[model samples]
Target: MDEQQGRARRPGGRSARVRAAVHQAVTELVRERGYGNFAVGDIAARAGVADTSLYRRWGNLQALLSDVLLTRLNAQSPMPDTGSLAGDLRTHAANVAREVTGPDGLALVRLTLALSGEGQQGLQARDELLADRTRQLQAMLDRARGRGEDPPDVLEVLDHLLAPIYMRVLFGAGPLTPDYLDGLVDRLLA
Candidate 1:
């Protein structure tokens, strides 16, 4: 219901600010402590929201884990589809470089990989995220193939395309600059 029409609604207005805050709190806490030892009370306090609301919405940490991680990796970002393989790869590399180098992105990714072995649900979420990314990348390659480019070995290209970015993000091997992204694309394409 639209509040401007004077209809009744929840207290946080239409932007769902409380919901986002709670989810962010969850993400931060998970990044810090994984999913095992934290209490709902602590989470609620951290979020500055009611514990009841958190429980009512998330039920448990793993469910919220699935929602936030999968959303960030799969749905929150758009895949590059610039109609040419080189252009698409450059765009993809740049976007990923931006995301992985950011504070929240690095923490979330580190937490996801670090915590995946703790539970089946998290493992499944990680698996789904990987599959989603693979499908998106494959679509880009398939588009190039349709445009009369050589039939690409998608997996081989994926390694060549993503490894340097991951190494830079995870190990601080290099800066995630446009030069780095362009270099990766050039080397892969060459």
Candidate 2:
């Protein structure tokens, strides 16, 4: 197994086992069949859990899928500390692009968009995830400021870099090539 795959998911317990199984099943199914297909029964059968168990714990497939995304995206990654802010941003951009464009990751994004709903009240789970991402992005900018770099507005950075990249990922407007990644990092830091 790869390093990430080798890492333990959860300690033993009936509930933990069920969640782990469900997470594994979701990742597999999403990989095989993009976000729009796949039903709760399929997940339940693959997870070795009853439909009631899934419904009781997660309420619905969208919630379960969001939970899976939260589990993956909330993982603690070391902040880029490459001395110069530019280098750090490049590192961060590369990491973000990889995670955003990876097969499973893209599938999660697609799923989240489909189920994210219209307003704040509708996309509560997705809002929670956005908050988490906002905090993480703030931390990265804060680190740059701590090192004496006059970082630009965090929201501007998000608007310029993050949103466009996500658009590309979701819309397939262009390739996430090395040049594109480097250009984004350079333009943002400029």
Best by TM-score: 2
Runs with alpha carbons beyond 4 Å of true place in candidate 1: 1-22, 31-60, 74-76
Q: Write the per-residue lDDT of candidate 2 for residues 1-190, one digit (tens) a residue.
A: 1332233344675677887999999989987886758888999999888999788777677767777877777662334778777777777777778888775547546765766653453277666666766787788788889989988677877888777778898887998887898898788777
lDDT at residue 170 of model 1 (Cα atoms):
80
lDDT string, candidate 1, 1-190, tens digits? 1342232124567336665676688777877886666777877899787777765665555555655665576554568778788888888888777777766657456656745865776676667556767788888888899998753476766688777787767886867878878987888877
- Give candidate 1's whole-model lDDT: 0.69
TM-scores for candidates 1 onward, in order: 0.70, 0.74
- Root-mean-square deviation (CA) per prediction: 5.7, 5.5
- The lDDT for every candidate, in the order shown, is 0.69, 0.74
Instruction: Give the total clashing residue pairs for model 1.
Output: 0
Candidate 2 C-alpha error for residue 96, in Å = 2.3
